[model samples]
Target: MDAPLPPPLFPALAAPTDRPALRCGPDVLSYAELARAAGALAAGIAGSGRVAVWAAPTARTAVAVVAALLAGVPAVPLNPRSGERELAHILGDSAPELVLAGPADELPAALAALPRVDVELDGEGSGAVPPPAEADPESTALIVYTSGTTGPPKGVLLSRRAVAASLDALAEAWAWTADDVLVHGLPLFHVHGLVLGVLGPLRRGGEVRHLGGFSAEGVARELASGGTMLFGVPTMYHRLADALPGDPALVKALSGARLLVSGSAALPVRDHERIAAATGRTVVERYGMSETLMNTSVRPGGPPRPGTVGTPLPGVEVRLVEEDGSVLDGSDGETVGEVQVRGPNLFSGYLNRPDATEAAFDGGAAGGWFRTGDMAVREADGTIRLVGRKATDLIKSGGYKIGAGEIENALLDHPGVREAAVTGEPDPDLGERIVAWVVPSDPADPPADAALADHVARLLAPHKRPRVVRLLPSLPRNDLGKVLKKRLPRG
Candidate 1:
């Protein structure tokens, strides 16, 4: 029609310009309109700019994100209601040349000087025009920042090639079809929401239902609202299960789902079974991180194993390697050493942090290999079982190793505990023992420490059972919804 622009610069996504692209509230924008809105916004901003969209999960924010991608600018999504300190820090880090906000909300005085773009195409002032560059596989496409171990936030750079390859692998491996309708209710900032939930579906012209804020009730309602798939974190699944009556509807929708997926954090094997019991479907727990969108997933249509994050997807090349970069000989399961993966889906580098990049590549080179900090033992059946995270999440007691996740999973299966996070605290003899912080689903019936200890005693060996268990309001979780064990209060 009008010069046929580069097929919208992505293959997995079909520019469904004729079909309704974003269905939000009472408004629906056709794919053509959505593209135009994004293209206009893209054209309005300078290349080396930052665009902070509404932090809340929404179809509108989804549009802004895609438009930013096509326009060749980086969009830093932030919570619209972020605290002053958080907003301040992110603004400083991203250093956007402009800001994007909807009508009616006044621009923050801090960003008053920055040109504001109205989603309705009101701000027409041209800053520097962004040069047209083909979406390079290795070039940085997005910079997602996380509160670093200790310093300013660190941004994980994902290039177009990386995301594209990820989509191809997921679509093929999970057998996602363009016709699938996924009800995704996770926060969009993390890799799971962005890579798997949003981009994965959109790239293939699948339908997505968005919740501005996640509510288990809202998610369940939406799932009943013509959804064919459910993709969310284990926490989300838990909330959904709790909100529902008996997990029947949860299971019904989940069982009826073309696929039910969980990632970003471990899906406790027990929760997987609990969700399946309630919903009548297996919640396929997958594995990946910010560095790699999705390398392995528990089978969707097949077994949906309780503890294993299934084999590597078709395009992904996985190997077990020693710390010194030597490949291991352990495919008895599927070669479980430190998981070193090379594929188009893996990220190029961490943004502007050469030292971090160098350290990341210590186990391998820079093609597509990511030395995942996860210590997993691949089984002979091609399934991988995660032992724990190297950076954190592993607890040592009495010279043996126990994954905090394993202990937490056992606690959650007790039916009394709602949430659990295990960490290593000082112990005289065992060096370090497992300390679990638990949140009770039923406050009145919260199990006592002795009761929980006994329950865990049945599930784990005497040594692996939690040495100490404490009830809490919630576990410390980071922005990405990962438990911050270091932040857990010492008992």
Candidate 2:
């Protein structure tokens, strides 16, 4: 009696095809095969409201998420590296009816109490009975947990409409189509690898080849073998830049890519230049956060410059507001202000935390604008150049507000410096003192504090120069390659 339901999130899956849809390491699946597999799995979990997926960096993880979406069930992806306390919190908060994982995956003690379903990739369902594709678009599709740096990780509820909008907008921005083959080894839990990397391609009828783990060799092999696009964070690009000189295979692979994107954190201008110099391609940087799926990205056509995240995506409105709550009118590329955005790509709210949900929407230019907490300067051409996080990256010293990112970029420009993180410490005279954490190219002979201080003073204002320089073997980073500034030693 009812009309056949429409596939909103993934219309590509409905079409008949034997083309390879997803590949993780040695495991690969065709579109038809994946549809059948997910359909079968979906039937088993149809009535289950919310499902917990152990997001292992494997093909089975992708299958679990797809099955959840097919059944119209909200799926919560648990980080594999989450500790007991964090795991317990997520499990208790979400309270999934069943946990889905690969057969070989060992369940942690926190998840051992829940009923488990092993996602079987080979399972077959009658191709005639596909999961109901039509559903309320506002229904929660995913419950992604935040990093919880301030406190316990809050769950972000992303709806089907939001997911669809984000993917379609990105497709338009990057010129992403079914013909494009995306390659990445990013973890399956995060939005970059899961939503954008896997789901983005699936929505467009494109193919994806996940390397399981990132390496220059793996990247080269995939790109050489039909991979057209690459997605990575700053750390990955840095490694690629480091390898380009010695590894001709890596150089050739990157040169062949149609598009290369960097996100999660700002890719240093030096690394961007290095990669471009080695390969005739420039790595385009995009700005996004967990709350907002994607806000801005460099245009796909050509002439993507370094250090700017380009203009806002279609259907997304971005504005800058000063600390006094005045909307920035002109794009002068100098005045720094907090970034605010409003678009369909935004999440519904923080699951079970109405207080946080309200706070996230407290201040904005136009009503309903989600405060991004990220600070940036808008260029005359409407491009966004990020300064840093408002909480940590914006440093007020000697009656002037300085962004740590600019100083960090200056430090990275030095040939002797391999990596750098700049932070502000309490100073009685200047309000806050600039501190530089340096990872030297040759740790045995680290650059002197005075030389590095002078380097910053010459490049930027004398007040922006580091008051103290501490040499380290490596900077503290998360799985996404974002610098964990809070984890840095205070002394």
Candidate 3:
């Protein structure tokens, strides 16, 4: 028989004192305190099947998740901002035994029907409970829901082995250590802020400070005061770029940081250059999704290119395949193909939806490759540059397969343009006509559609220019700052 695996995801729990394990706003807990608190919560819910977490962006949410993991129960992180219908669907689909939340957090109408457990920082514990009984590596750990662009949101099953493998791989790739103090204000529902932001620090036995909310002043203060790393999406970085010229404190904070990373969506090259110019620090970008925790990242010691997502992490095999399913022989850095990945980091399958699960894997479970549905160009050096989603971002027009991302980037380069989103609408002659939705840098001096279209043609191929351009006050965006292209008005 195989030896039992240790229950705690964090191995260094036994040897810690005085160092903050997690700090959100003013709530702080040391490693010893965390162990005590989590142990108590774990003991209380040791035998629950699957659990739902009211994932508020707070230390309490972190504690509840850790406690669930310690008890070896799969956790479902519920997004706080979800609409009533979306919330109802997720709760019904996952069918968790109970929901966990902080003592003071108010439950939404969607979660009120379920049994509730409140977590307390100063909760009593009999002391550290015995390690949970050894479970199979394939046991489900988290059931994260997708954005449901195609259909209803489906829960992606993530296993213990997958989480451990991904976090460890990222630790090695990022040179993450206990000495590093991570800081971010991302919401707790997504993988970026939850798994990478919260769990990443816990695994390394380091500290994490969540701002409770994001602001340039808040981030600057945290980074200026012992925070070594900052994680954010492009929107947050754009705010940083906008604030750099006036805020000397912000400039000093960014310049002194050990690492700056952008994810959840691609960071525009213009914002990258702006931040770099102000602070002389290159912000690294990584590629990941809820289905796959993290596939690639710019290694800590590697060069931080403006737009590339570096190479695959340790144990992850990433490759590009043509539409016909044949793998590219060698990347020319121009051939666009679908991104396929196979690694321990991959999710088990979608929860209870065997048909959908079966369709995600290429050959079978034995084949081990999962089609990501994202299209990208792979450089010869293995760096992956995402073009966009296969369903929406790839525009087939005039016998040319152009990625909307490139044209969007070109449009953003215009001095008068502040934000840009590109989409393809049906056209009889071109198959799909490129449409650009833009926000002007200055509303009074907005660039004409012809001028902006000409700008893109000059920067890239003429065919890539927008056939129609519409000016909006702002692009529709999600909590993670991803541009919601589907929500754009089709006129």
Q: What TM-scores do the predictions have? A: 0.87, 0.97, 0.97
Please identify model 1 stretches exceeding 4 Å from their true place.
1-15, 46-50, 81-83, 105-110, 121-133, 246-251, 320-328, 331-337, 363-365, 441-451
Worst 10 residues of 2 by lDDT: 124-133
Evaluated with lDDT, which candidate comes out highest?
Answer: 2
Which is the winner by TM-score between candidate 1 and candidate 2? Answer: 2
Model 3: CA > 4 A from native: 1-7, 14-16, 129-134
Estimate the TM-score for candidate 2. 0.97
lDDT, residue 174, candidate 1:
78
Which pairs of residues have clashing backbones in candidate 3?
A: none
- Per-residue lDDT tens digits for candidate 2, residues 1-491, read 98765456777676648888999987899888888888788888998979999999999999899989988999999899999999999999999999999999998899988899999887654562456456688899999998987889999999898899988998999889999999999998889989999999998998999999999999999999999999999999999998999999999999999999999999999999999899989999898888889999999766867888999999999999989988999898878889989999899999999888888874522258899999999898889999899998999999988888889999998888999999999999999999999999998888899999999899877988999898888898888999999999878
lDDT of 1 at 318: 77
lDDT of each: 0.69, 0.89, 0.88
Q: Summarize candidate 3's per-residue lDDT along 1-491 as a digit string, tens digits.
A: 98766555776555546678899977999988888888788888889999999999888999899888878889999998999999999999999999999888988988888999998887564575434464567898889999887889999999988888999998888888999999999999888999999999998989999999999998999999999999999999999999999999999999999999999888888999999899989999999998889999987656667678889999999988888989977777778888889999999999889888888878876556888998889788878988889999999999888888888888889999999999999999999999999999998889999999899999888999999989899998988999988888868
lDDT of 1 by residue, 1-491 (tens): 64533333343333334654455555556556555665566665646555766545656567667767867676776655556676677777777777666665565666676677666532234332223554444566677766555566666778777777887778887788777877776777666776677777777776667665667666667667777777777777767665556555555556567778777777776666666766677778778877877788776678668877898987888777664667777666423357777777777776677787767765444554677777776787878777667666666689775666667778888878878887888899999988878999887778888888778788867777877878898888765567887687757
